[model samples]
Target: MSPTRHGWITTPLTAGLIRGALDLERTERGLLPHRLPARARAQCADPQLHMAESQPSGVRLVFRSRATAVELDTLATKRVYVGAPPRPDGVYDLLVDGRPAGRACVTGGATLTIDMATGTVEHRPGPVATVRFTGLPAEAKDVEIWLPHNETTELVALRTDAPVEPVPDQGRTVWLHHGSSISHGSDAASPTTTWPALAASLGGVELINLGLGGSALLDPFTARALRDTPADLISVKLGINLVNTDLMRLRAFGPAVHGFLDTVREGHPGTPLLVVSPILCPIHEDTPGPSAPDLGALSAGRLRFRAAGDPAERAYGKLTLGVIREELARIVRERAAEDPHLYHLDGRDLYGEADFAELPLPDDLHPDAAAHRRIGERFAALAFAPGGPFANGSG
Candidate 1:
């Protein structure tokens, strides 16, 4: 046990105790975990990228403790689109000895309100919210407090009746993955339940998720973030965001993919790298995108997305899931000839047509909680099984 803070043992929030976050900012109130570094954040002025990266998807506070009670102080910021129904507050999950022990939510904090139709933004401030968990086994065991994957939370403090010790590395492979919002834990049950998080558990690896929502547009900054981070295995799940934003055509995309890969190779030239294509989204499977929210559904307190592109635009070099997959597979094939450690994975294999019928993407763009589990299981079987690309370390 350590010195008491207000009658309870306390621990300083430090980088070593936080996992799955590339950077941590010492904010005025507390420490804030960020998936991207300061340099990468400085390169982008977009509010969306800032919000997504700040929402700690796979980030968690892990330690070894025997305390029967634990508490965390946080200042969480939630988003509220003026017209659309509000999303649920982010959930905090506690795992004891690698199994779930408790779950809770912060009651009060700040809010960011946006009027999308008018392009107006509003911020409302609030007080710190404390998430508490009691009734533990009262024996020494590892505890992992997974942050709310959908909320921007600043860690204020952590307190327990017993001292918290640093968790020794398990020598597991560290898997660093980057992708769109689906990879960002959208619509998933909670932080640890995100597909990538689940996949990491089943595959027995440490996770550093860079799955920024609506911001994975093959930006050089994001590629540079991936390049610099240390990892034992790496994968880039691309194409969805490019098509979702209707950002570019075939000509621009091909070179962008090559450039992103080239940047990552500069940091770890021989590390095994996997390129993943978009999963099956019926609306974007054949049609082009710039998917728009179903405003009518939103008026009914529902959230859904519809492709806003012209199907005929495919002939004009517009991109779709099918086209992206073809090009990604081709690119990996060509690159693998010279870079033996490079590989490709079809997202369809992760969530294919059959799986869709069984559990469809409720938002038409993001997978639901159950689908997240299914995809995680499938990914573990594919990538962690014998002879898989990431079976080796990132080195």
Candidate 2:
């Protein structure tokens, strides 16, 4: 059939064309993608988790279409820390037939400005913006629109010159992963370039990322979500968020890890499950946290994080990166005796002391774009290579 120049066809955004997110909520304006399902969201009242899950990290719209032009209408909620430099506009990455093709950005959207010192928040609503891509090959092809990883986007409409249909699964192994903001693409360039996305590309697997920024606190709801989601391989990067939030003591951490893994095993008894500790965060390695923003640096137009807890507090069981690494390794070792499919990867193996010496974390916390690339490549080789835990035919 020849391409038509008729009016744009509007398709309802549904699960068939969306990947990574666990649920979609119907809003007055459009569909909102959420990392956590409605059941999980209803159980938690933390504003942090609510905001993080809505950011759509590693989420994308995938379909087969012959459209020469596509336009997406979206309402984005972008965060801005008071006194910090304005963040660059979020990019929409377009992939056609499994190759990078084009990129575009939305102009206007709502803004949430937060005062770090006072814990005050102000919201400013902006109009919906349209992101359009043109001159796509006028033939049926697999298409993907990778949503912004950092901004909370409500997809209002999808308009194409030709009708779009969900792409059929290609029989690739599904890799479901959960972690903190680092896994959520904090300093990465774009959605598809996030470490997990990059690693997924290299490992040739379909990724469903549950990387909730600042919200990976071993929450029961998250573990339940993981248990219910189907996957050939699973990983949960633990520690940083728990320490930073100061949410639990060392005593609570052990049982939480076991409970999270137990719930997941109930559903995926034989699946390869990897437990990853946090990468080196210099500020929080020996020192425990409630990590606080470095107000001195922020005033000088730089953003940096600092650990507030004293090292002496370790005597009292405060958690730190060093302590977390030991605990995670011990847990995985003990569990592997009974569950052979279980494995542990010290995150430092992905970005260790030497790498840190050369490419130090720019903000004393999150890795820069370069570090993300290095970690992604290393993870692909370590976990997905032959004889490794996630090897293609190992199961």
Question: TM-scores for all candidates?
Answer: 0.96, 0.97
Give the per-residue lDDT of model 1 (tens digit) for 174-290.
899999999999999999899999999888888999999999899999999989988778999999998899999998999999999999999979888989899999999989999
Candidate 1, position 137, lDDT: 90
**lDDT for 279 (candidate 2):** 92
- How many pairs in model 1 have backbone atoms within 3 A of each other, for residues 3 or more apart or on separate chains, i.e. clashes? 2
lDDT of 2 by residue, 1-395 (tens): 22324678888888898998999999999999999999999999988889999999889999999999998999999889998888878888999997999988887899989888788989999999999999999999999999999999999988899989999987778999999999999899888888999999889888889998899999999999999998999999999998898888889899999999999999999999999999988888999989999999999888888999999998888999999999999999999999999999999999989999999998899998899999999999999999778995322
lDDT of 2: 0.91
